[model samples]
Target: MQNNIKIILKIFIYQVIIYLNSILILDTFHEVRGYNITPQGYLSIIFCWISFLPLILLNNQKNPVMVFLWLIYITYIIPVSIIFPLINSASVYSIIFVCTINILFFSSILFFRIIDRITIPKLKIPWDLYKILIIGCGIIVLLFVISNPGLSLIPPNIFKVYSVRQHFKDNTPLLTMYIITNGGYVISPLLLLASLYIRGPIKYLLITISILISYLIYSSSGLKSIAFMNLAVIILYFYIKGTKSISNSVINIILYLFLTAGILYLIFDFYDPLIHWLRRVFFTPTLNTYYFYDYIYNNNSEFTTEAPQIVSQIYYGTSGSANTGFIGDGIARYGTLGLIINFFIFNILIFAMNLSSKKVPFELSTTLYLPFVYTISNSAITALLLTYGLLALSILLFLFPTKTNKIPL
Candidate 1:
């Protein structure tokens, strides 16, 4: 009874804080940073704390690996998303919708798997599945890199789509959001390789060298952020299942947190690879490091009163343009309370994922958690499945059928 009541109270508080955060056009005191943080944001923090009290009461009675698998998947979509409606922009709605859509997507995948069970007239998992999956994963990483290198979380370079500075409706800033939300490409090959190989110090060294080489000239905030994020996800999966070695467990957790601080620093730091590559692709210097801060702080107060614009730039090919603020700016919707809720949600989910992961074997757990590492690299946690290729390869575990051939088992 007490546990249920606490959950009810937390839910009520979460709703109230969410309501306060959505006062974009309604609130009179919104623009003042210090003023809005109280009623709206602070409550989110309070309730966010309240929500975690149930974890202690809950027990993991199911299969550890399976439990982690579910937890990791849920961690990505629920924690922060349950409150996404509180954000002032349509993108927040989009993020929620995306999570819903992803759930459906995975459900469809699950449904397909179930269908396979019933309609198995003649079943043959692909014989060459491992090679195909491995190569496919590498190709995916390459494609993501080639296609979306500029989709950085706080891209120093300002891209003008159709015209300059005025091409977007709501001018929905894509770069920061892209970096902040999506990171499914960077660690794909690394994780895939790790899954396929018997990992040793040498393999890790080589993988680290590859990452360093990739980011040697320009610090790949997106790639590095995403990489570490994948790692965190892996760590969570291991802990949840009780599979991790004690030292490995502590190291992974620390590595995950360290990546967070590093990515935050990168978001503030400047890097110019285009200039280095061509020696003169410089149309302009990078935007001010403090530009996002200025926009949020200066424009947030009621005194400014200007709505977000819908202009476009003629440079790229778009009908919309946007100003970049904090990609994590949605935290401000509920004020300081909401900020706490938002942060607490992330940490709690991470903890949940960690606890659940302990159910899976250490060897199997890395595959599950690899994407969390990449998520940290760029603050992109929009997808729980950070690495697109991991799925393709997981399919190969069936294709190759490593059933009784367990080396470590």
Candidate 2:
């Protein structure tokens, strides 16, 4: 009873922090930073609270993937979908209907257990062969990057990355592009895992090389996510490795980090990084919800089936892509029906991840799973599964040796 109460209190506190953070963004930056807030009446505020109550059900301890998904949804998606829309005076009916779909999609995580009934046939590959294959792929990817658009073309700064990214996409062969992009996802996690379970200077060397390669990839491809991908995986590996409980530990860590950041900001009045983080992590991703909805539903725009970056640029007459969360992307493409389709597709991906989890360590599976979950915040579900190689990642997880021990030299 005491533990349950403590968990409940933590959940409550976490939710309050998120709610307060939304207020902080609104109150602090509404006019000064051009946040686009136009408050509706107090009744809409009540609706946001009611809409967010389903998050408590998200405290399920069974799946770490689900916990990470909920963390992003609660900390970012809910505010954008619910609070931001309300403040913007978007149609209440539209907001409620779309937000309900999001809640249902999140709640369906409970059904992921059904995936356990479908057994995946184990593949028997020698560990030596597997390592060779991963390393060989990594080498090939590096060669591809070096040859196609040599490091001489490295961008000056992250802001310049898009032009270079666009150039790479436009100039590189589609098939080669596919291999190089997907290979990064496949090889980086394996490298991180190898470094973790394997002990010695070799491990240090591997990680150092991985970080450098990530930096080079970012410089060449203009993808900021790729630059820190290995570090994120390493952090997640040790984080879950030390925890006794996965779901609660995840919630507590997120809560404490948020609180710590908030406190530091208050004490020091440090707004630059905090504002940037808020814009990236919260404002831009969520605001895309409003942008897509208004574009499609209110403006009577046709369902978009084109590249999101192209579509967003066309819509806004802007240079940058208004990359949006999956929910927003669905709305942009399919209207009300897009919501259902994206939800179903996302659940399928989760089911695949859940099935693969049986063949790997839970921590390893969840760590590998983070990128896909995180990507859903700013990419389409179709792009995530197909273009982003999440389906391939699931198969990779399923094939990972069930018994991971120290790497023998």
lDDT of each: 0.34, 0.66
| The candidate that achieves the highest lDDT relative to the unseen native structure | 2
Model 2 clash pairs? Answer: none
- On residues 273-367, what C-alpha lDDT tens digit does candidate 2 reach at each position? 45667556655676666667767766788887653564457545555677877788788778878877777777777777777776567778778
User: Which regions of candidate 1 fall more than 4 Å away from where they truly are?
Assistant: 1-132, 139-222, 227-400, 406-409
The digit string of per-residue lDDT tens for model 1 on 332-397 reads 233334334434444444434443333234445444544433232123223333323323323333
**Candidate 1, overall lDDT?**
0.34
lDDT of 2 at 103: 72
